[model samples]
Target chain A: MASLPPKHRLQSSAADSAATGQHEHHRPRGLMRWVLTTNHKEIGTLYLIFSLTMFLIGGVFALVVRAELFQPGLQLVQPEFFNQMTTMHGLIMVFGAVMPAFVGLANWMVPLQIGAPDMALPRLNNFSFWLLPIAFTLMLSTLFMPGGAPNFGWTFYAPLSTTYAPPSTTFFILSLHIAGISSILGAINIIATILNLRAPGMRMMDMTLFVWTWLITAFLLIAVMPVLAGVVTMMLMDINFGTSFFNAGGGGDPVLFQHLFWFFGHPEVYIMILPAFGIVSVIIPTFARKRLFGYASMVYATASIAILSFLVWAHHMFVVGLPLVAELFFMYSTMLIAVPTGVKVFNWITTLFRGSISFEPAMLFAIAFVVLFTIGGFSGLMLAISPADFQYHDTYFVVAHFHYVLVPGAVFSIMAAVYYWLPKWTGHYPHLRLSQWHFWLSVIGVNLTFFPMHFSGLAGMPRRIPDYSLQFADFNMVSSIGAFMFGLSQLLFVVIVIMCVRGGKTAPAKAWDGAEDLEWTVPSPAPLHTFEHPPQYRPVEH
Target chain B: MVNVVEDRRPQVRRTVIKTLVVLAGMCVFAFALVPLYDVFCQVTGLNGKTASSAQSLVHQEVDDERTVTMQFVTRGAAGLPWRLEVEERQIRVHPGQSAEVHFTFRNLGERSLVARAVPSVTPSPASLHLRKLVCFCFENQRLAAGESFTAPLVFQLTRDLPPEIKAVTLVYTLYPQENDTVTAAMPDDGKHIDAVATRRWADRSSGGET
Candidate 1:
């Protein structure tokens, strides 16, 4: 083994003479440090805490929506307000909740995983994190505008958005532009840090799945965020200017809006989940005590999924009356996506097969993700059948399919990643029993909430309706109850996380017996600066 | 030193490939701009001929107790029967001008129907101002029992309306409500009477001038 780098060597020598027990440095004092700091770990904490706050806020909006839909007679809010709740709920969850959660994880883990001193562009990292709160504040403030918030669906179709938009739509579009800027910048930072700052001997293939997946995800974000920016900019112009971009009377076709929206939208779905795939890829291997099965294939499969995302957007618009040939093409391309997705699923299951298994909270969530996300994938495949989608489009079936994917797929994975890495972040093991309660309640509440929606949709209930037909009454009641439970269960997660942050059983450097990674090799509760000199890498021989 | 040099080769190659891939991607996406721009044009209705006052309309006052008989004409893609109705049975109109008519509808059977209405106009387009005095399409409406109701549209023919142009049409589509909404024998290209035909009686009373 090589000696520590010169700077660390000096510090360790000084520590050896002076200290007998583990000592932690006082956190940098003052607000100015946070505002101007370029430290990756500090910025990472900011991203995580900000995202958690957004999650709670977005969760409240979801509760509002469920409360209104609880008995189907607009018990709590008007239909327009319900529309705003749904739109803002989706916007905040995707941008504020899931994406930033993953970015937070990246900031915490990337430097350690790659043996880098800090992110390649540390100032940019801080800027990215800070941009989130500003963007979301603008978005959330729109709720109180004169005509109320963006009552259009988060998808924000035309004519509905143009001829009938509220004054706040302009502000909503600008805020999204800001959020897009933040995402693209964060993605660029991740890409540069991963590509340029890895330790001397760490080969591209030698990096952990988390880093590899994030590297690809960063590229995806950079590629598509601008497209989202472009689309929203066009919406802004159409609203303010005399543009007939989506107005039929002005010689524009409304369906064209769907195509552009879904093009950015489809890749965006992957952007939200791909890093979760990275998180699970790391967790599953550690708990199973096996190198991830088919490592090369996993990378290739992820790349394939990203590539396939571009071709399959039209699958979202099966009912928009596309030409037959185009419909057939999109159907086959969408179905083909199932193959790479299957490869990912198969690899995860086989990694777990016949392995000495443990049910740590992180592992528990990962395993649940495997099952629940697959349920979502199957529903997605059912939707891929174009004719069937004609029936399912904008129905509760579609709603069930996405929430299953998003809540369990992205949200659970974020929870799992936090549990997996919390020891490193805090130098303490979280309260296991509280975490278990959080897990079980979330699993039950999430399934109970979304699973009933499939039946309601099959029975011909449309989505986005504040009130539903009486025929859908029973399932809606069940779903509403489930939604409340699900929302409440998430609060338990908040408690567990806060408790973990405050104090817990002190953890050793390698917190788990089987955990193997460069990150674990570092000190518990990693230093403000990490791997100031590149660490050497030796690949595990199978 | 030798191993370092050897490792550097593939790293450089990877970087080069990565660069090329990004460049190629940018190029391909740059090309995509044309189609996306076209799509943008289509979606925003930027490329098609627009009705001068297609979205909102304005109306002039009806002369009190002046029985101004008006005719309605319906036309669109053939095989789709169009319907229209007036919320009020009759309204007084100043000579050489028009007033709002409430047109209501239901698609009795299957195939999609595009409904167009030409109101009797003394003057049209630039000369006449057509105002949507009130409309329910702005909100959701459900028709009852093969039902119908009138969407109120008000307009005044400008003195400039070509005397030959005595009518204006308000067109919309009755896309067959999804199958879930219909509960009877689905018609295969069903033919139904056009509502504008009822205006024929009004036209006869108004001297069948057109």
Candidate 2:
């Protein structure tokens, strides 16, 4: 029996399991249940809760950096603390907040969208979500250590992050290794689920854009997260093992660190946003009451963008003295990426081009995403001109550019996703007036904060500085005020989520009249068990 | 449905193992970039950096079909008082050919000084294949006031030099060993590789002599 082929083993196991019953007949009670749970929805809830917590914690670090940068005189925190703040803010937001939020959404939504009962490997899903808290906790603890946290910034160049690093940098390396392992495991689970678990009639093309995008993003995670693991392992060896992988004095090249980092990093950014693209693609058409303008084109654009991300990493290092040919090559390749990105923007806009259109809280955020993410993209294109990046590299302009793409671009899509699906999860609608207020305030607050950085950066202010000269003082103040306004307003978002969860206007199975995906076909406040017997999947006509 | 779940588990296991293989492959690629980038730089002369440091001279026969122009450029460090002159600005040599070129180092200041010249080759793709039989830049030159010395450079280009490279330039920048200049007046501690010759040069010093 042990040497039997898979078919024979399956037949024997099926006979044994059918003689018994399903294993989740009764779940444990209290906190222990969550600790030991292998259910996808419960793990998704854990991921969301954990992400929300990290988002606020990372936001606090950002606010402290802003507070210190408010007047240019360094009134509040020391330069060292300010450096730690900036570094922690970037690391936490990227690894902790943004990525986990997407994974949480995928866990909750992927199976539902594909008409699968649960994630392919539910135990691995639990393990992946649990790994985040352990990794981040170890990282956050570094701030209390004698030399303080990793202060070379999130891109953490060598020598600075190595020879000049804090004693706790080794711990940072270990934690990232753990997180990288978690990301790979999570990605493997998702790819397995999407490939293996869809209902009988659903073909690859029939899957929702969200599922499709996550599929691509999952592939990206598998490919690049290992590269990240390798680079960090090199950093570990350089730190403790007397290796010189990033040391120039010992025959190693520091430029190699940048090469490996942005290799993983550029794709890591796409990992953050591709799922957001999936989210926005789902929301825009659902509200506009039209079929997505180009479904196949949207999928193709995502793939092309992921592929192009690999080729354009050197654009970030334009000022690092790359050869003329390499610079020109990266510059051209960077510009080529805009074609696919433009396709995505146009697809969303054309979906909104006119039919019956109404602005739900979710749709409003989606619309803002298209307009604002395009602004970030254009600025990115402007930076891609290798000649121009000489002026823009490491300036607040680069800061503003990525923040725009991330906050309004990725974060807004996440918000829209939450707003769109809160009804399904809670069986109640979000408080509309507060949601509108959250929308408007976030729209205004986000723009007010980052938009002025463009001007300040053009005027030659650099980033990661605790203080600046008097001339850049005014712009910093406005940005600080806006950041505060933005920070405080997100509290309203938390409140809306709580309010929706506790009680609100009850929702029907199809929460939005236009919603027609497999998820919406299930009852509101979906039952603990769904698609256990497998639901019939009908391909939606595009 | 039970059969479906049971049947697909093996496939899922297979996909998981394959995905893990891809992950491992990417990890290997990251390390591979190190050698790949080195090879790329060697091929293109990227950044004009020599890919491998020359330790010992290589023995190779010359190819006479192609003649490559070897140019010499010399510059003295900002405060070093040595002037350098090359035998020729550019000399033609065939691939796998060995040739000798001479350089004169003149001490202009009225103090005894020690100097070292660092050499770099351009059209850097040719640097690795240009083996040096003997070169004075490998060691220091000690010159007293009003003293000058002429040195010879012996080298050969490899037989397989790429056809695209028609010319290569070698540049040297000379810098005074400041500590050696200060120690010029001190008693010999016998630490110098050329301690006996350094004493002879110090004996011939004119102004600022010990």
Candidate 3:
């Protein structure tokens, strides 16, 4: 692995890129410019905007669920609709919102970081991004279908999702297949670009942590997206073709569904979070005015987490009558994940220790990600203990545990990346005052929304239910209020991106004082074409 | 730069092709997991499915000192209307000796229905040696409404069966079958046309309520 590149090398690349200023002007105009664009930046913009739209849509689905759970009685939605909301919320957030957002960031950054002119396959990139809208549109239209959208939980355990599934289940299976194909394509492009397109003389180890994580994440995507495709295809068969892959009535085991889903699913959890680790890894060091602690260790830890994710899938099936030995194997393997995760958290903290740390919005989210994501991790550890999980399974405690990791851990990291890179993307600093307001409100709102779930879940409030008894009413009420608060503050984020794009404080080529990635080597608001000529090669010295 | 990009084109294309191949293999691997999961459960005896089929059955002298209790329990899958009852609900047997248990199934549904009863074992490890010589689970049964059909379940537990397992409970759950071949086997009582009967069957299977 190459050591950290020294600062002077950046100036040379910048001068070299500036010298070759031949930006192309023959792009398609108006709607077709976006519709048929193959440029990485344009596709990146489409992915980000698309993810944000999905985020809002998924957020409303959450609000609907929250509204129904605001009291003991089901006031806002029926039990059937409640199931749809929860299912859609999980599906949309994971597949539509979070995954796309990360890919969008990767598209915008991986090429720039590696000094490539574009993604390895730009047209494929366009196709992958376009697949999502079709996949999600098909999924959403199922709400209007006779039997309604997938009412099984996001896991879609069969025979519930097969023999007993609504008429819309086949469509659900198709939509997921489309999305899985999209993910596989996107992953291939990333791996190709990273492996084959780095600037001359920059070895694999010299690449930025963001690029490193995406590379690993991309391989994971390739490996597991197909399994997802496989599992859903099985679902499709069971639903339409009368095959019994999951239908116990047909001699297929329902437990097999959990095994297959989690095989794809547990790794999918890491798919959402590993890049967040990379983002925070990038942001914490930049704002702290320090080189990242244990950069090699961080990469190893990310890999370790991805590997361990596979072995720990059965932990999710602990309550399903797994044999004792199987239970212990999954439980121990799951707990072992904490070691690598601990390394990451410790590395971040060490980077921040006694450094010239700044309280920028990006830094704030990065730090919050450290504190709150750890909270999620602790709950995860609690849930990992096979016996304790019996108490917490399907409870709001389980709900609280994941939401903490997802909202604060993954979503916050995305926020941090957006804030950290906004200057480079738009050539202007975000409105600082409004950004701070969004930050504080989001932090408070997120905590308020998910914290009480631990109490209610311990009090035995199950998840995905439209009604709870009177004991959980107060927690549900406070949670709904916080949900609205958290949901509304995200609108401010949309405003900040728009305002920063339109006009704001100017940012120089090197956006942050301590930033060292090659992305900053190009001018802020990077040109359509960059690194057309591979900049003269010189690996930086630490 | 154009030369660098062009030079790497072959490598990128190779990498993409290889990755796509892996993607296809994994998709196939997921389907492979179906039989693999069943095999895994059978080997571990974790899901109550037996690993020992008739081919693996071997001759063994009876272990006179050890007696094992075999009990029969039957249930129906969601909407199955047949009631399965064994003539001998509980029987004591020597580990290596063969035993035959008779089961009677009566279709409670209005029309003749095709059914299959799948067997499972409790304290799952015991299933590893629970061999079936002749069981009705090997084929489907069609019983007319209120008609009772009897079948024999002949099985042997190897003498090597662990002494710690004094008792084994075999649960057989009846599930309605809809195979095209079975439809011919089903004696139509002239209750309704083929289309209407099938629609009702489909509705009953999915609806959870007849």
Candidate with top lDDT is 3
List TM-scores for all candidates, in order.
Answer: 0.75, 0.82, 0.91
Per-residue lDDT, model 3, residue B185, is 22
lDDT of 1 at B101: 66
- Give the alpha carbon lDDT tens digit for every residue of A284-323 in model 1: 9889988789888898999999999989998998876565
Clashes by residue pair, model 3: A5-A540, A6-A540, A6-A541
Report, for every candidate in turn, its global Cα lDDT versus the true structure. Answer: 0.72, 0.83, 0.85
Q: Candidate 3, after superposition: displacement of residue A213 in Å?
A: 0.7
lDDT of 2 by residue, B61-160 (tens): 6676789999999998767788988989899998877888878788898987887766767765577677765566645677888688776676788877
Model 3, which residues run further than 4 Å from truth?
A1-25, B1-4, B51-61, B87-92, B183-210
Better of 1 and 2 by lDDT: 2
Instruction: Candidate 1: list runs displaced more than 4 Å.
Output: A1-28, B1-210
Say what the interface RMSD of candidate 3 is: 1.7
Chain A TM-scores in order: 0.95, 0.96, 0.96
**Angstrom error at residue A191, model 1:** 0.8
Q: Per-residue lDDT of A35-89 in model 2, one digit per residue for the tens?
A: 8778777787788888888989999999999998889786999998889999999
